[model samples]
Each structure stands twice: as C-alpha cells, then as structure tokens.
Target: MDKILLNGMAFYGYHGLFEEEKKLGQRFSVDAELKFSLKKPGKSDDMNDSIDYGDAYELVKEVMEGKPVNLLEALAETISERLFQSYSILEACRIRITKPDPPIPGHYRSVAAEIFRERNE
Candidate 1:
C-alpha cells in the first residue's frame, strides 16, 4: 500500500462541548493518511491517474470549516466518511483531529481524536 499525507492542517473552528468553546473558537489540526495502490498512477505518470489530493484538501477544509460539533470524534467521522465516499480508489484511511489549548485546567499540548476505516468486507 502507498500513502498520500495531508499533515499539520490547521484551522480556526468553533467545535467543542462547552459554550465558550463554540463561541470563542479554537485551533484545530488535522492529519490524514490516504492509503491505496499507487501502481496505476505511478505507471501512467498522469495527475488524473491518481487521486486529486487538492480535492481531498478541499474536502477536509469543507468539513472542518463547516458546522460546529461537540466532539472531535464526530469531526473525524465526517472526514473519514467523506473521504471514502468521495474517492473510490482509497482502500483505507486514517483521520486525526486535534484541539490545541482546550479549556481544561491541566497543562497539556492538545487533545485529539483518531479514526481509521476500510471498505466493508
């Protein structure tokens, strides 16, 4: 399997379980791994032969920049679902959403939710 990585994606989003979080908004980071066989694309050496990663970036942006959600888990699901739905060549994928500087008291770098999915057997 081969991978196309969209890493360290940052956006300002109003997504959280708290009112202040939704109102004030916070930073979000996303990392995704798109897994598939690169043979066809590599052999063809054509952009269209492979998945359009720019489209994938746009897809992630649409989800992250769209509506506010109470949990990163849901956000991850949305991204994963859309990826599988939008791209037929993808055999599996991993989506990780991170919330930096969450409202928690303890000092921490960030909180994240990760989801991995493959085509149903």
Candidate 2:
C-alpha cells in the first residue's frame, strides 16, 4: 500500500490525570501514516484523486485542540476515528501520540503510544 506521512505535529493542550496537569496544559506531538492506493492520484496529479494533507492536518489539529480529554489514549482514538471518517480513500492508518517531559518522580524525555486501524476490506 502507498502511504503519506505527517510527523512531529505539536499541540498545546490540557490532557492529564492530575488536576494541575489539566489546568496547566502541556505540549503533545502527533505522527500519522495514512495508507491508500495512489495509482490514480499519481497518474492524474489531481488533488481530487487523493487525500489532501493540509485538510488532514487541520482535521487532526482540530480534534487535538477541540476537546479536553484526560488521557492521550482517548485523544489518539478520537484522531484515528476522525481520520477514517474524513477520508473514504484511507485504507489504513497508524497514529502516534507523544508527550514530552511528562511530570513524574524521575526525569523523562517523553512517552508515546501508537494506534493502528484499517478499513474493512
């Protein structure tokens, strides 16, 4: 399958288990790989023949900043569902959500989760 990748998208949002974390908000990074058949688009070089990366980015950004979810898992799931719904040409997708410098007892650079989904064949 052909793929399009969006990486290192940053968003500032309130999402955490702690009240302080929710109030303060933090930075989150997202990466997505959208899978689809690209033959038609490749041949035609038409925007209508394939998914628009700009539109996808905006959709993801809207979902990320639109709601205040306590868990990254929920945010990731929401993104995945939105992507699937927004583009009928998308056959499969992998979404990664990352939190840099999470609040913990010890110092840590980041934590992330990857979620994968595919349209029913």
Candidate 3:
C-alpha cells in the first residue's frame, strides 16, 4: 500500500486529434503514482529493493515523446502497460497525462486523462 510519486514530469510530444497539434507539438505533464510494498526497501536500505524511478521516468518519456498517438487515453494506457512490464514489484499504477495547451478553445488550466491499472497476475 506504500506509494512512490513522480509528479509534474514534463515532455514535448505530438499527441492529439488535430493535424496542427501533431505538426506543432505540445507540452505534456505526466504524474505517475506507483504503488507497491515499500517494506523491503525500507528494511534493506538498498536501491535494488525499491523501484528506480529514474528508469521509470525514461520509460514514460519513451512512450509520451516517441509515438504520435491521437488520444491521451491511449498514451496513458501504454504507460500503464509498460510500467507493469518494466517493474516486477509494481502492484498498481495511476497515470495522468496532461496537455497544457490543447487546441480546444476554453478557459482552463489544462486537460488530462488519468488511468489506474493493477498487475493482472
């Protein structure tokens, strides 16, 4: 039930339904909540017992910055899938992808898609 939070990780990506969005690209903010038992890490005091969040960040970066997905939902899905794959100790994850300047005309801070997934095994 313990948690490790990676917040406000920013990236530039071309992910949207509009051609202009794909062409111009946009800023994305990702917040990932990785859940698992932290007891081992806490007791061992070793990096190996805990998830290396630096690695997790790179994985999210690859998905967010690599593909030109048209929906934030898909983006979050891919991230969740990869997180489950990359970290064996990860039990569940909450992924939130936010677009700071989406093409939609509105007065708002930003729009985001959030998803929660748990390990299936």
Candidate 4:
C-alpha cells in the first residue's frame, strides 16, 4: 500500500481537560497517514486519480478550528472519520494529535494521542 503523509501540521486550538487550557488555547500538532493503492494514480499521472493534500489539510484545519474538544483522543478520532468520509480511495488512516507545551508541572514538550482506523472497502 502507498501512503500520503502529512507531518507536523501545527494549529492553535482550544482543547484540554483544564479550564485555562480551553480558555487560553495552545499549540497542537497533527500527523496524518493516509493509506491507499497508488498504482492507478501513478499510472494515470493525474491529480484526480490521487488524494489531494490541500483538501486533506483544509479538512484538518477545519476540524481544529471549528470545535473545542476536551481530549486529544476525540480530536484524533474526528480527524480520522473526516478523512475517511471525504476521500474515496483511502483504505486506512492514522491520526496523531499532539498538544505542545502543555500546562503540566513536569517538563514535557507535548502530549499526544494516535488513533488508527480502516474504511470498509
């Protein structure tokens, strides 16, 4: 299977269990891996034959900017669902949502959740 990878997509989102985290907002990073057969697109050499990165990015941005969730797991699941719904060729996908510089006492760069799902193809 061939894959289209979107890595280190940074967004400012209001998502957390804490009140201040949701109110003030923080940086979030997303990495998405979309799996599909690339033979058709590679052979045809056509944009329509393959998934559009711009479209995927826009979808991710929309999900990040539209809702205020309290958990990264939910955010990741939403992203995975949206991708599966929007794209026809995707067989499976994985979404990783990371909260960078979380308001935790311990020194940590980020906290993240990785969710994987497959389409009923």
Best by lDDT: 3
Leading candidate by TM-score: 3
Expressed as tens digits, the lDDT of each residue in 1-121 for candidate 2 is 8999999999988888888888998999999999999999999999999999999999889977876887888988899899989999999999999999998778889998898889883
lDDT of each: 0.91, 0.90, 0.94, 0.90
Per-residue error at 86 for model 2, in Å? 0.7
| CA error at residue 86 for candidate 1, angstroms | 0.6
Worst 10 residues of 2 by lDDT: 63-72
lDDT order of candidates, top first: 3, 1, 4, 2
Clashing pairs in 2: none
Candidate 3 pairs with clashing backbones = none
Once fitted onto the true fold, the runs of candidate 1 whose alpha carbons sit more than 4 angstroms away are none
Per-residue lDDT of model 1, residues 2-105, tens digit only: 98999998888889999998998989999999999999999999978778878999999999988999999999999989998998889999999998888989
Off by over 4 Å in 3: none
In the predicted model 4, the residue pairs found to clash are none
Q: In candidate 4, what residue range of length 10 has the lowest lDDT sum?
A: 112-121
Query: Root-mean-square deviation of each candidate, in angstroms?
Result: 1.0, 1.2, 1.0, 1.2
Give the C-alpha miss distance for residue 1 in model 3, angstroms: 1.2
In terms of lDDT, which candidate is stronger, 1 or 4?
1
Better of 3 and 4 by lDDT: 3
